[model samples]
Target: MIRITDNEFDKLASYIQANYGIFLKKEKQALVTGRLQAELVQNGFKNFSEYFEYILADTSGSAVTAMINKITTNHTFFMRESEHFDFFQSEVLPFLHSTVRNNDLRIWSAGCSSGEEPYTLAMILDEYFGNEKGTWDTKVLATDISTKVLDTAKSGIYSNDKVGTMPTHFRAKYFRRMDEKSSVIHDKIRNEVIFGKFNLMEERFPFKKKFHVIFCRNVMIYFDEKTKTELVNKFYDFLEPGGYLFIGHSESLNRETTRFSYVKPALYRKK
Candidate 1:
């Protein structure tokens, strides 16, 4: 593996933070080195500096996508933070069903890694609406920076271990067996999620319509307080009044600094 010098590391770290809002602390230098070293050597780049320069010049965008895919951590599984789903079903769904006038429900999995989180949302929406699902437009917009994971998500196939975390009935109802070791999401569930590539650090969010519920769980953990605060504020702007935001259980926002009302642990409301 090729070594990344301190100069290269700083340059790469700053680029990631500036463009993606992921703050790589000094301690993460080794992690940066390890994740990227093999790729750098294999691609015939002697150092991180040369690779980044090529990434900047590549207009087709594949190179940038590759670097983000390897650098960003995408570890997540089905039904992660189950209580949030529980609340979404029992409390949130009922409210949206009653309140939303046009039968269009907007749900966004902002950092939907490998389709697990958005798939879970689609499944929950599927069960809740049932026959009524046909009348309402309940597509969940799932976006991530990594095109590699988005490709995996679009495929809607998962290894047995990833699907194993869900309940048996969930397994039987929403997924079909692909093989001995994998499962493919059923068409009903898969069609409900629209995956796209998005970067949170973009100067402006491009959505014209606001969402009723946004699930950006576990993603803000990679960002620092300033970045986190800025992104949270942007989330606030794009949500309709009375909409809910659910974040990772491990992450929190300062009530004193944020516009969102504290609803529960890792859950906030736009009042």
Candidate 2:
């Protein structure tokens, strides 16, 4: 593997942070180099610095997209964080039931890697609505920066180990056996999620309608304080006044920086 020099590491890390707000700390040098090696070699680059310049010169932005896809971590699975789903069902949905007009619920799973979180949400929505599902528009807008994971999310196929973490009833209800080792999400649940490629660092969010709930869990951990603050405020603006925002249990919002009212650890509400 080609070794990444400090200068090369700084350049790539700075570019990724500036463009995507994903803070690659100094300690991640080996990780960055290792993950990017195959891409660098496949593109005919012998060194990190050369590949860095080529990425910058590629004006179409596809190179950077591919770079991020290679470098970003997208390790997530079904029901990875069960408590948030429980809260979404018990507290958030009831509020929406009383307040939402047209029986329409717009939820976004930002950084929805490989579909588990949004798929889980979709299943909960399916179960919540039951026979009345057809009468409501409850589609989930699931987005991730990586096209690789978005493709996986769209396909809705997973190893048995990943999807098996959910309840037995849920497993039986929403998934079909693909083989001895994997399963595919049922089309009924699969169609409820709309996956797209999104960059959270965009200067402006492009959505005509605001969301009732936004699940941006575990994503902001990569961001610096300023970037996380800006993104949280953007999420606040895009969420309805009373909507909820769920972050990873390990992540938190500073009371001094955000308008979101802290409801619990890693959970907040716009007021």
Candidate 3:
């Protein structure tokens, strides 16, 4: 493995924090080394310094994209944190359906990893709206920083075990068996989610419409206290009044610092 120097580590860590809002501490150096060792070896780079320059000088942005992909972990499965989905189906959906005059149910699956969360939400939306689904704009916007994961998400394919934990009825209705080992999400659910590469650190979000719900679960754990506060505020701004935010259960907001009202564990409201 190509060893990283203290100075080289500092430079790379600063760059990641500034550009991606991902805070890497000194203790995580081993993690950085482990994740990025293959990239350096594959490219014939002798050290982190060379790799850093390679990323900085690449104007097409693929180099840095690849760097982030290696350093970030994207572990997720369908119906993760099941209670949030239950709340969405039982309370949020019914409220939005009745109150949203435009019949446009805007939902976002921010930091959606490998497509499971957004696809799961799409299935729920399909089941909830049923016959009236055609009349409503129920599209879900799913975004992630890694292009590799975005590509996987866009393909809408998954191993059978990945979708296996889901309830039997959902597994039967939403997935089409391609082989014994894998299944593909039916186009009905796949089409409802629009996948894109997005970096949450961007100063401004590009959307014109505020969302009715934002599911940014487990993504903020990488950020520091300041970064998390800023990102949470950004979420608050992009959501409509009475909108709901679902975060990782392990994460909590400082009630003193945040504008969002506490609703339950890992859930908040924009009112």
The candidate that wins on TM-score is 3
lDDT of 3 at 261: 97
- lDDT of candidate 1 over 1-271, digit per residue (tens): 6777889888888988998999999999999888887678878998788998988898998887788888899999999999999999999999999999799899999999899999999999989999998999999999999998999999999998899999888999999988999999999888999999999899899998999999999999999999999999999999999999999999999999899999999999998
| Per-residue lDDT value at 215 in model 3 | 95
**Model 2 off-target regions past 4 Å?**
none
Poorly placed runs, candidate 3 (over 4 Å): none
lDDT of 1 at 14: 90
True-vs-predicted CA distance for residue 23, candidate 2, Å? 0.5
TM-score of each: 0.97, 0.98, 0.98
Model 1 quality (TM-score) = 0.97
Clashes of each: 0, 0, 0
Lowest-lDDT window of 10 residues in candidate 3?
1-10
- lDDT for 125 (candidate 1): 90
Q: In candidate 2, what are the lDDT values of residues 16-76, reduced to their tens digit?
A: 9998999999999999988998988899898998999999899998898889888899988
